[model samples]
Each structure stands twice: as C-alpha cells, then as structure tokens.
Target: MKKIIVLCVAALSLPIAIAQEKITLTQAECRQMALAHSEDLQKADNAVMQAELDKDIAFAAYLPKLDATATGTYMFPDMDMMGAKLQMRGMYLAGISLTQPIYAGGQIRAGNRLSEIGKDCALENQRKARMQVIADADNAYWTYIAVLWKVRMLESYKAQMDTLFRQTESGVSAGMATENDLLRITAKKSEIHYQLQKAENGANLCRLALCNVLGCDLDTSIEPTDTVIKVSLPAELDTDISMRPELRLLHKQVEAAEQQVKMSRAEVLPTIGLSAGYMYFGNIKMKSEVGGQSFTQKIEDGNALVSVLVNIPLFHWGEGTQKIKKARLDLQNAQLDLQKNTR
Candidate 1:
C-alpha cells in the first residue's frame, strides 16, 4: 500500500516537471522575434519593396524598347489588266522594330525623381513602424514588471496582516486586545486580496498585449529573463530635428516637388528621339503575265533604317500652365510640412 501511494505521488510530480520544462523567452529575444514576425513590420517592408519596384519601372522608361510583329493576308478575286481574269494572292510577312527615346521633355527624369522620393518616404514609414513596435514592447514589458512587483508587494502585505490577525486573536483570547482589532486586520486582508486580484488581471492583460506585439499565441507563457531598467531623461534636449526620419522625408518631398516643377517647365521645350530598326519582309507577291505564261515566286528582303524625331509643343490650352502651378504649390506645401514636423 505504501509503495502504491509513492508511485501515485511520483506520477503527479512527473507531469508537473514536464510542464515546467517549456521554453521561456527573454526580453531581447522577444523583441527580435517581434521584429521578424510582426504583421505591421512585414507590411512596411512590403511597401518598401513596392517602392523599389516602382523606381525600377520608372527608370526603365529611359531605356530602349524592342518589339516584334507578324502579319498574314489572303486575297480573293484578284484584279487583272485589260479586263482579263487573274489568280488570287496570299502573303505572309514578319518584322522586328526598336525605338530609343533620346529625350522625353523631362518626363522620364521627373518620374524617376518622384519614384526615388516615394522610396524614401516608404523607408521612413518603415522606420516609424519599427519605432512604434519598440515603444509598445517597452511599455508592455515595463507595465508587466510593475504589476508583478505590485502583486509581490500585496502578498507581502497580506502575510503581515495574517500574522497581525493571529496575534490580535491571541491577545483577545487573553483579554489583552479587543475583537475589533482582529476585525480591522481581517478587513485589511480582504482589501489586499482584492488588490492582488486586480494586479493579476493587469499582469495578464499586459502579457496579452506583449504577445500580440510579439506575434505569438495569447495563451503562450512568457518569462522575461531580463530586468527592466529605468533611466531619467536629460534636462535639456540634445537631439536635432534634422536627424529625424520625418523631417528628412519631408525635405526629400520638397526637393522632389521642385524637380517636378522643373520637369513641368521642361515640357515646353522640344524633345528629340533617336530611333533605329532592322526589319525583314518575307513572301512578297507580284503579278506578271508574258506570252500567256504566269508564275508565282517567294522572296525575302531585309532593311536597316535610322531616323530622328523632334517634337515641339507650341500650345496645350492651359494644361501645362496648370501643371506648373500645381507643382509650385506642392513644393510650398512640402516645405510647410517639413517646418511643421521640425517644430
């Protein structure tokens, strides 16, 4: 019977030990995992990737474009000379062409510049998301630690009150203290219990928030191996506004807008294009009749050509003027935003 009791006790202890062997996460480890797994960060990174793709697309416009084309045709009831009947003709042709843009009225340049600005903005937005995640994690970690400390303090207070209640009971029994004293201590103990409950709830909530930021299961247990360190802020501000990502992004926007204005003005100027192509024509048909003898022949010919195209915009109603005005206003607004963010 004693052996059976010992075996049961050992079985219970085995499960408890297994439960305690689960993995625990340190604060730094949690932060690193959050940086890699957080949904918000991933979205920000995707935005940056999209911006880069846009930049690539915009830059591609400056390069030459190549294309190939083919055509087939069939004709019935072919026309004849001197009111005589002729045979029908069928033909097939194929060609390749290339066009290079030497100039585009600054449109390509402005587009590339805008893409660069967009990329910068996307990067800054990513930085902001990262900072927000770090701040949130910090707040959650500190709050959790604070609540845990509060729980410990409440437990300590409860233990002292328990001892006091026992002493008061003993005193009352010996006719040295009144029952009211014991009742007061009991009331205090009840209040501490309520506080402990509240503290536990707060700690649980903090853990949930931390888990959410870390992109982990809500029920997963987290044990912060690192202790929270408190630091006092400096009395005087030493950080400069120019170093802030917000300010830098705004400045880049202003510069991009200025470039846009310049590009818009360039639209009024002439554009030049250098185009060259090699084309092949196959299966050409020609009708011929000599001494009442008719025949068909297949031929192929290749040709290379180079040309230059120049475009001068004399007038476009008020579209160009409107664009220039819009660009100027955008530059002004970007400047104002930069100023505001700096402040």
Candidate 2:
C-alpha cells in the first residue's frame, strides 16, 4: 500500500515537473519568434501581395479585350402578304468582337503608375511593421530578464536576512545582544520577506508578458541566455531620415496623388478605340409561291467589319473641371503632409 501511494505521488509530480520545464532562449531567437507571431507583419505582407495584383490589373487595361455574342430566334406562325406566304422557321447569329484602345487619355498609364506606388507603400509598411515587432520583442525580452534578476537578488537578500536573524537570536540567548535587537532584526526580516514575494510576482508577470510576445505557453519557464548587457557608443551618428519607412511611404503617397491628378485630368480628354467583329448567320428562309411554282430563299453567310470609335467629352456642367480641381487639392494636401512629417 505504501508503494502504491508513492507511485501515485510520483505520477502526479511528473506532469508538474514537465509543465515547469525551463526554455532557454537568446534575444535574437526571441525577436525571431515575435516576428513570426506578429499579425501586423502578416497583414502587411498581404497588402503587398494585393498591391502587386492591383498593378497587374492596372496594366491589363492596356491590352485588347475580346467578347463573344450569340443569338437565336424562332417564329411560330407564317405571315401572308397579298396572297404570298412568307415562312420563317429559325434564325441564328454568332459573333466575336475585339476592342483595342488606341488612346485612353493617359488614364491607363497613370493608373499603372499609381498601382506601382501603392506597391511601394505596402513594402514600406511591411518594413515598418517588422521593425516594430522586433523592437517590442527586444523590450519584452530584456524586461523579463531584468525582473528575473530582481527576483534572484531579493531571494539572496532574504537568505542573508535569515542568517542575520539566526545570529541575532543566538546573541540574545548569550546575553551579548538585547531583545530589542532581535525584535528589530525580526521586523526587518519580515519586511524583506514581503519584498521578496512582491518581486517574485513581478517576475512572473514579466515572464508571462515575454511568453505572450513569443507566442509560447505561459506556464513554460524561460531563462534568458544573456545575463549581462554590453553597452557601447557609436563612433559616428547618422542623421539621414530619408530612408526611413514612414518617410518613404509618405513619398510614395505623394507620387500616388500626382498620378490621381493626372487620371482626373484624363477624364476630360478625348478617347479613341478600334473594334473588329466577325458575324455568322444561318437558318433563315423565306418561302413564296408564284404561278403555282414554289421557291425558297435562304440567307446563310458570314461577314467581318472593322470600325474606329472616337469620344469627346463636350460638357457635363463643369463636373470634370471640378474633379480635376479636387484631385489637385488632394495632391497639395499630400505634399503638405510630406513636408510636415519631414519637418
């Protein structure tokens, strides 16, 4: 029975030991884990991919478009006109048309340019997100390590106080120390104990925060590989801010606004297109009887035609002009924003 009880206690303790297993990780590893776990970075990547697809879609506007059409009709009754009967049974028509844009007033080009700028903006956003995640990971990692050190320091201090309390008790028994001294040491030890408990709780909270950043189990103990930090000063300071992702994104936005202005201007300009189609028709017939002689006439053939189309926006109550002005204003706003951020 004792052996059974011992076996059951060991079985219960096994999972607890496994659950508290320490995981040792370096700062770099923690940052990498955080990067992998960051939803913002993933969203940034998706935005970049969507931008690329938009660029492709914009470029497709420059290519020719093809369309197919088919039609069929049937008549249920014949018609009589002046003693002559006209019979119609079935009619069918099929055609395929190709339309190519000769000119679109620079709208397609400007749209493509805008999509490219959008892609660049998404890339900059991704870079910014990556940097942010890494910074957060580093902060959490170092903060947890610091708190762990604090906990250890408090434990050590508690041990030293305990030793002092014992010595004081012995001295009081030997009459070398007063009871007041022992009481003073006991109160101090109690304070130290309270402080140690608080530090341990703080350390646990910090550990949980680091685990959250790392996307790991909170119950898993973490031991940082770095115990001491090495501080260094840069030999030279670099003040260039143009390469920053935020600044680059702003620049891209400005370029995109310029493209929007161009696109708006294009709305008022003339557009030209070329279209070609081939049509086939069959199963159409007219039956007629004259002088007791019957005859049937059927029309079944195929024909092709090409045409050029031109459009000029004469007027729309100054709508196009207003749009152009609005786009220009937006462009100005973007420029102002860029200037403000740069300053």
- lDDT of every model, 2 decimals: 0.81, 0.91
Worst 10 residues of 1 by lDDT: 81-90
Q: Candidate 2 versus the native: TM-score? A: 0.90
Give one digit per residue, the lDDT tens place, for model 1 in 76-190.
Answer: 7665655444433555666677788887878889889889988988999899889878777777777777787888898898888888888899999999999888888888889
Q: Give the clash total for candidate 2.
A: 0
lDDT of 1: 0.81
Question: TM-scores, in order shown?
Answer: 0.84, 0.90
Candidate 2 structure quality by residue, lDDT tens digits, 1-343: 9999999999999999988978899988999899998899999999999999999999999999999999988776877756655555778899999999999899999999999889889999999999999999988989988888888888898899889888989999999999999999889988888988888888899999998988888898998997778888789888898999989988888898899999999999999999999999898777788888988888799999999999999989999999999999999999999999988
- Candidate 1 TM-score, true structure as reference: 0.84
Leading candidate by lDDT: 2
Candidate 1, backbone clash total: 0
Q: How many pairs collide in each candidate, listed in order?
A: 0, 0
